[model samples]
Target chain A: MTTRTVARRVLTLVVRGRGAQGGVWGEAVLREFDETVTTWQALRWAAGGIRVAMRERRRRAADARRAGARWRRVSRRIVIGSATAAAVLAVLNQFVVTIAYEPSAGMQPTLRAGSRIIVDRISLHFGGLSRGDLVQISLPTPAGRISAFKRVVGLPGDQISCRDGFLIRNGVRVDEPYLPAGSTIDCRALTVPAHEVYVLGDNRAASADSRIWGPVAERDITGRVLVFS
Target chain B: MPRRPDTSPQTLLLFRALLADPSQWRYGYDLSRETALASGTLYPILIRLADREFLETRWEPPEQPGRPPRHVYRLTDAGADHARERLAAAAKPSASSKKAATAPTPRLLGGAR
Candidate 1:
């Protein structure tokens, strides 16, 4: 083979070893080699190539350091964002709607035992109470305050009485569609005073409510029931 | 692995070459020729200096078509100051050494007189 062929073969091998570092440096080396073809000059060019390979190795180490710093910054942002979302959800649950499950037959047919329900605590703050609205009440008992679910029957200043399995509101018979068929309600007449409401259960036959414990104060109502399953 | 530039003869020679024209862009091949340093010895020093921010690099476009661009380097502002301070500190003699050098030796008077 001619000297030029040999030179070309050597140059190709050296450039291949350059690999990722080959781009501009490789081209410069090849151009310089083409300008000088003597054996002595080729040896000098090989020496220069070795220096470039060492420089490339150091450059890779610096790039790794920069990448590590960027990864740490991204991880910190993710953790902060997740914590912020959890806090907002907690606030919404406390002041807005909350999910709960019915554990008794008090509000049956409308809300069966073990029914999942959503209570709107915010509604009581905006729209005030009204008759026929289902509510979660905190009833004061001898043991402690126990929570109960019932439908509002009589509002303040209304004469409420139960006669022959029916509800009497302000001396007028009121229709109760939520109550189970054939359920009987027998109780004496009593007027719900100011800031008080009479509440009752849908399963009147099996429930202990206003007839037994009397009317509940307006302050004892916890939340208005919105949805049930 | 990255390393700090040592105060070896080769390293000093390369630093002197760069410091001679602190602002001008110096090509790698030209630097190698001027300093009489092998590629293996010269490149590591340049890389270490650049990593420490004592040198800055740039790519200069080729003067002719079909020629690849060349990588050129120069001392950074901080690098020039650091090199000057380090070199000057090395050249300055310590107080004890300076006092010893200046102290006059007593002459043998009897035989000479």
Candidate 2:
């Protein structure tokens, strides 16, 4: 191709590719004298340009470093700000259930008889309770057994009972799918109280839930379990 | 090209290795095998170094016309300087060592405290 044609082609390529104008022109300058510049030639120019740029950058960086007093002051303020934020978050997590402990065998098999769990207590902050959600209630007493971990079997005034080892709710046999095989219950014919729940365990034979202590008041409910964690 | 202050140990090691021949681009698997770093760890550092302008990365077009590309990394001018500094720093011991060597020692009281 002719020199003018090649220049036009290169110009068109530069426009189409939208390359770095400085670097591309630097390469173009090499191409003007010869059809193609070897990788070494291009690299040599790049190295020289980079060395100059680096020197300038280093000078600017040194000036910034000399103004360390201002940067130190800003950094200290930022550190203090972050520490305060972390402290606030720690306090918030304590109230919102960062961890949970299984006090008894009330909701066994699924959550184990006495397994300690780290509850994501924030789950209930956005979403409400659902049936079959094993919940932990935060009580005022420091009895070391303040939280009651149990599965929710009934809602407010949701008629619930046991019939022939089957959970009967609202005149229909509520399916207890998670319950272990050959488990039985004799606690039958009970109406869930107002603002109270009819709770039970998958291990009906060895649970100390509503059957023993009666229904729990809604005010006692702390938060619903999102996961075993 | 800006100097990349690499905080990660893996990145510091990688920069030192690349300083030997920076223009010769190294592949991911080769770097991973040579550095003994997991693929997950190596790839992230490569990307982070590239982001900080310490390294330049490119995907080598596959030998076949329509095949997955392989990534390659090379040290930029800024990366080379930073790597040299890091290497020099690694070679030198801290000023604290001298104080430790000459500091007064406390004698044991009753052979126990």
Candidate 3:
């Protein structure tokens, strides 16, 4: 309505310009306005103050935009970092090896219970299978499907038999120090079929093995036990 | 290093005004009148100068009762030196014509839209 009133409103705008920053400048301009001797002078001062306020508001908006961009970069880095880690682990598990800790319920004595073991998937394809090596097999049990570690004792065409507390393969008694001393696990000398091997658990008393489910095919044996850590 | 503010005509005018009394505290209103700068243009330069440590500011008690305290500013030693340097450089011949200094266009603040 009046020049003085308009100047006063403009002074308010100057303080609000700090809405764009900290309001120190706005206060500075406001305090100066109080010293203006005429309404005309005050109006002129307030016009200038408005421009300053708009500049401050624009400056603050830029700062906020920069901060928003920084946050986006940080979140993107977190997401990309997690994704890369998961992919590397998946590749290692599929092609290199699978690390597992097993409570050696079936295969024991040699592989102590509660020890950590690594299944060597790479070696399963490279190295030839032997009669005394420990292997990981996926086969069926009475309850359901099972993943187990067992000792290989009978190769293809080998007649495996248990006589006098020892495991005899093709009439040659194999030295099984891992089995409990003088433990007799009765397995009739059945000829192992081609592409298969007879496997038995070292904890012969508690284990359900080839004696219960028959020999496991070579394709069914997934990996060889590399180490008991 | 502290960032240097722009060297427009208004900014040069302000430098000349402050250089007249380098150590004495200059009031914002007096500066606007002395330099013929709009309060809008005069203040942002003052705030920038203070922010860059080229100038120091203080609040002086009013001369009379009921009058609010005035915000006063004075150039620092660095600001005085810089002001002299800018004035001396502007005096020398340059690529641009002198008319641009007398009525320079207003530059936009913040980012371009």
Candidate 4:
């Protein structure tokens, strides 16, 4: 095609991009192309018209966005976003998993004071309690109830006792590997009742557990410490 | 109001060209040739001027056959006054420079041209 025809088509496109108000300006640009000394200059002029079309399009878009802006539109988005996040966290906190801070040094050597732990709430409900499982359960306190982290030393109908600085479960000498060497425990032998578990802290010397408070009901176990962690 | 008139060097050149023929309605190409501004740069400035009611525009039929009508532009009275004010402000820095050469303390100039 000839440069004149090509330039005319391009100028037409630029005018269309500019929309209604730009049609007049587009005419001015198109008419001036014929006055140029050469076809090349006409093409260049048409090319330059593209810039005007682009600028007009951008300006119109910005103006439309500004005109349609309202507080309700922006505020609704924020509200919905926050509500969705809170609801998801709530479900995760209730059933899937929960974040807990290890409060005191009762479970020392394993969990330090002020350490953070992820408790798997779903596992305890799905998988039955096993011996040596670290579990979080609520224990009665003077004011109300308090959560405690301890290792289950005895399960339902099992005999448990601390003797000669070692743990004995079901008449078998169970090595207390997690505890500090030479740690001593002198608790009497006790058979864990049905639907209950006997628990103790890894720091046997410093813990107040089943030896002093007796067995914890299986239903009272809140969650298990994540095995992966 | 349509905001302040553009006072860039190129825009000032356009203002001067228009002021040179304030009474005559001139075609876009004629003004572009006089001011040496490309059509792309020229049209947007004219649109802004028209939007601000600083320039008036019209359509004039081509004298020959098989030719489209031409867009002709002339500055309004307000545009002429604005162009004059801006031109005078632009000249003040040079005028002040000559005064500074004779004065003991240097005086700060006003807004940028």
Candidate 5:
């Protein structure tokens, strides 16, 4: 082939190769440069997002540190206050009392079975028991047992007895509004002991109180039933 | 000192992964796998962390006589402390919206006399 024809063929191959690769020489260079620039741009955008996130995180951390310190201070104050209150309550629960208990199922529907009660043990301590107050006393424990609980129906210097399911205290037929169903006693009449209380259960038939165990001493009394929970 | 694009997040995350295990030397591919970044995105971050003195990088021992060595990275003491700060920041709530969401209030009111 002629040298000129050979040169023309070579030129055509070069053009075709450039065309297949999809660029002019300068365009190819510019495209590569653009790609490099775009990659860096994407990275820069990602880094910017990361920077904002980091800054926000830093601010939040500072705020939380301050808040945590404040909360700790508040908690310390609360702990101190609560501890002082608890100490006062403990002293009262030890020296003075404010709770009551029933000996048996005396006032069933009104009080209930196995129900413990909180009494103003301090109230009875100041002003003594009247005609009918549900009081608790430490009865005679037959050598080896704990104290007992009962209701006071008659006080010292009173004539106490139960006739036909009704209580008679000091020549008058007393009305007991707290009696449960089927309460009946066999005692006729007896003189109350000096400085002692004649106690009985609201359910006279089921109770083993002063009628069986005799009158209770004044010092053996604990308190009266006030609140039921 | 052209700010270098504020690479604190990547630096912090890299420091965390490194401090979580100080004895083992982590490479670029290991860090990329742990942090879920592509090679194109991760290599530059590694280079930046190394430049900041937050990370130390070295050529790892070759597995065989003729095998290419891997580049390993680890966090410095300052880097670990910065990571701790970043982690603390990450654990905190971002705005008042979160506080409002968590605060409790009375559900009912007593009748007005």
Candidate 6:
């Protein structure tokens, strides 16, 4: 056989081996070898084809490493972002304020049933409760502790009475515009002792409040209603 | 697979040749001949350089009939700059500790005399 034929046979074997190994570029390398003018040059081209195969293997490995690094960076960012969002929500719930739903119409004109209200827990730290401010009070019950919303009608050391269907505070008639039209509250005279406040609901007839359970302690007040929708 | 391209003698020789004409496109066979590198050594270097973006490639159609097309390569602008900086850094000693290293050593004055 001639030198050119021997070189072609060697290159064909090499190309077939590369193809079996999944090196798709074998055809391109074989084409380049076929164009070589001499047998020596063809042998050299076959050697270059093996190097090309090795190069492709290295390139694939590098690409895999880069893809893994990119995925790790993306996962890290998601974790940090979620943690930051959760932290902001926790701080808002504890130190700032939160939304509370009024489930009953006990406070009627002041706060209707099914109304959404913003309860400001932070404001209580700066000031004491005043008469007529709507407050949330936690009362012990047989089932568990239940929270109730009502208006502060009398403060510590004040005379309070609901006589003849009208409220009297400190020997004077108390004007409560929030009461529904023609609503009447009839109860016996009672004095608000120290560290306690008299509370009443605007819907007098339907409310279960201080009139039934007596005055609530000042410490039972949790927050005051800022606004409602 | 090597994490980085091997800085063998042939690799540096090929780099010097490519750096000489950074803007000009050169063929593979021509580079192999100029650098006296075997196809086994030459192609791996070329693939590594291209992978690192230190070289760019394109295909050139045959100038005559029956001759197959071939790939050509050239260094990009950033590639050339990186090559220049790396070569310069390799050629010189680091300046950070030069002053301390070259300072005169303390000696006992006239004690042995």
Model 5 Cα lDDT, one tens digit per residue, A26-143: 1112121212224444343334323333443465569899999999999999999999999998777544655555545755555566667776566676688876776766665777
Give a tens-digit lDDT track for model 3, residues A110-174: 76667688888766666668988888888866887677888898889999888887788888888
lDDT (CA) for every model shown?
Answer: 0.74, 0.62, 0.78, 0.80, 0.59, 0.74
Q: Model 5 residue A18 lDDT?
A: 42
Per TM-score, the best of the predicted structures is 3
lDDT of 1 by residue, A37-75 (tens): 466656666656545654564565578888998999999
lDDT of 4 by residue, B29-88 (tens): 888888888878988999899989999999888899788788999999888776766666
Candidate DockQ values, in order, are: 0.17, 0.02, 0.48, 0.46, 0.02, 0.23
Give the clash count for each candidate: 0, 1, 0, 0, 1, 0
**Window of ten residues with lowest summed lDDT in model 3 chain A:** A13-22
DockQ of 4: 0.46
Per-residue alpha-carbon lDDT of model 6 for A56-110, expressed as tens digits? 6566669899999999999999999999999998777565777887888898987
lDDT of 4 by residue, A1-229 (tens): 9977887777777777545435567767767777877787777778767776666667877877886786668888999999999999877765688899788789988999887898888767767899889999888868887898999989989998766767888889887788877777878898999999999988888998898889999988988988422
Model 5 pairs in collision: A99-A119
Name the candidate, 4 or 6, with the larger lDDT value. 4
Superposed by TM-score, candidate 5 places the C-alpha of residue A39 at a distance from the truth, in angstroms, of 99
Compared with the real two-chain complex, what DockQ does model 3 have? 0.48
Native contacts recovered, in order, as a fraction for each?
Answer: 0.32, 0.00, 0.82, 0.61, 0.00, 0.42
**Residue A111 of model 5, lDDT score:** 58
Q: What is the TM-score (0 to 1) of chain A in model 1?
A: 0.58
**Which residue pairs collide in model 6, if any?**
none
Report how far off residue A177 is in candidate 2 (Å). Answer: 1.4
TM-scores of all candidate predictions against the true structure: 0.48, 0.38, 0.55, 0.43, 0.37, 0.43
> lDDT score of model 6?
0.74
For model 1 the local lDDT of residue A47 reads: 59
Per-residue CA lDDT of model 3 for B15-48, tens digit only, reads: 8889787889989998988998878889999988
Between 3 and 4, whose DockQ is larger?
3
